[model samples]
Target: MSLHEDAVLVLKAYEGRDEQQRALREVYLEHLAEHPDAMYKPCGAGHVTGSALVIDPEGGRVLLTLHKKLGLWLQMGGHCEPGDATLAGAAMREAVEESGIASGLTLLEGGPVRLDRHPIPAPCNWHLDVQYAALAPAGAVAEISEESLDLRWFAYEEVAAVADTSVVELLEATRARLGA
Candidate 1:
């Protein structure tokens, strides 16, 4: 199946934990149906982005990148590429690419951890982000990518101090999934 078809199926199967998440999923599905370019960056009407919160094996810290353009400490994630097979796979690929840990990073099994809709610069006004959690192996090492100014691991308590509320919320949801 095409990535677009995969996206639609993923969203359709997603069971949101809250009213806001459910609403976001509904709108995302609508956008997908309304715009053929919804899955790509050139959509002009915005597109779905995938992200992963990379947690340490001990569940003590998360790897966050200082986004090159946004200048904010955020999770490892970005636009869905044409080669992606599933939203979760896209998220995991982004995490691996951004974190520089090519192996031993496993996605948290349930599904997406959160949905964050935020505004971006035109021609795309928004990014409807489907967030997932990835567990990094104990020896995982991260290298900085050109897309980020910095890549560092932040303890659960330090996340709120260095990152925005969205990152904090993602962490909370990921931890809840890990039962940490």
Candidate 2:
């Protein structure tokens, strides 16, 4: 099946634990149904982007990058590429690429942690982010990529003070999934 079809199935099967997630799932489904290119970045209206929060559960810390262009502390994520076969695959790809952890990084199971819709510069009006959390193996070391100005691990409690609300929410949902 195509990535678009996979996204539809994933969203439909997503049993959102909250009203907001359920609402956003519908919006994503509608967007995908209306625009076949919604999985690509060139979509004029908006597009689906995949993101993964890098979490070191044992260390009780989360990895966040200072985005090169946006200059904000955020999770590793970006536009979908042609090679991406599924939304979760795209999320995992971005996570590994941005985090520079070549191996042992695993995505949290049970699908996406959350969905966030945020406005962006023109050409593309919005980024409909499907967020997931990746479990970083112990002793994993991260190197900053061209897309980031800096990369570092922050204690779970420090996330809110540094990252925007969306990142914090993703972390909370991830932690809930982790049962921490």
Candidate 3:
């Protein structure tokens, strides 16, 4: 199936209450089972595209986007697109597009260094997120878009204190995975 088709399926999966969504997810999982490499190994409800934890090098801060749809601060990411051959590459592209950072950004080798699975709330199934680490200099300026109401950098500790529990957990996991 085309990437857009896959995205549609995913969107449908996420649009329902938690229990209802789980049923829809089983259908997607059955589809994914046919194409193992195009998705990920151990493919199931949790297997989806990856996300990135972007860090500003100078101030030791992290970049976060206020997701328009979810109204929550989240890492820049989504399902992989057709142009992307790997989950990591799709994550890098999403980061650049969502953050509007023009400067060259590089992924930390051996990252997104963490992987985990979480439910997408009700009406939508679940996404198995593969998380990576990306580092950029502190001087980088972000250009916001409709996808986010705002984008900013926060000190790691400060971010942990303020961000939602799930985000905080991801941040902590990224730090531990990257030893940063």
Candidate 4:
């Protein structure tokens, strides 16, 4: 099946635990139904992006990359590629690629932790971000990729100081999921 079909199924099966998430899920479904090209990057107006907040198992820190283009400390994520089978797969692939951890990365048990719709540069107006949480195994080492100016693990408290509001929100949602 195509990524679009897979995304439809994933979204349909997901049961949001909160009213805000439930509303966001509906919006995402509606957006997907309205735009068949929503899963691809070249949609022109905007498109879905998959991202993961990689957390250490101890839950004290998260891996963040200083985005090369935006120059902001953010979670690891990017556009969905043709090879991506599902939104979650795209997020995992991005996490592995950006974090330089080839193995021992596991997604949180629940569905996506949050949905963030944010504006991007021209050629793409917005990124409908499906965010998930990934647990990095003990002793997992991260190497910076070309996409990032720098990559480092930040304490939960430090996230707010360094990252933008979007990243901070993602981190809060991820932490709530971990505690749940």
User: Which sequence of candidate numbers ranks them by lDDT, best first?
Assistant: 2, 1, 4, 3
**Clash statistics: count for each candidate:** 0, 0, 12, 0
- Model 1, residue 65: what's the lDDT? 99
lDDT of 1 by residue, 26-89 (tens): 9999999998778779988899999999999485999999999989999999999988888899
TM-scores for all candidates?
Answer: 0.97, 0.99, 0.70, 0.94
Greater-TM-score candidate between 1 and 2: 2
lDDT of 2 by residue, 1-180 (tens): 999998899889888779989999999999999999999989999999999999999999999999999999999999999999999999999999999999999999999989999999999898999999999999999999989999999999999999999999999999999999
lDDT per residue for candidate 4 within 1-180, as digits (tens), equals 899988888788767667777787788888889899999888876788899999995858999999999889999999999889888999999999999999999999887888888888888887888888899998899999999999999988898999998888888887777783
For candidate 3, write residues 1-180 as lDDT tens digits. 554345335444343224534554555455455445335423333447667877775576889998887878877777765587555677788888888886777887753454445676544446756566677755888889778988888888888665776577667766665566
The candidate maximizing TM-score is: 2
lDDT of 1 at 63: 95
* Alpha-carbon lDDT, every model: 0.91, 0.95, 0.66, 0.88
Question: Best-fitting candidate, measured by lDDT?
Answer: 2
- How does residue 76 of candidate 3 score in lDDT? 78
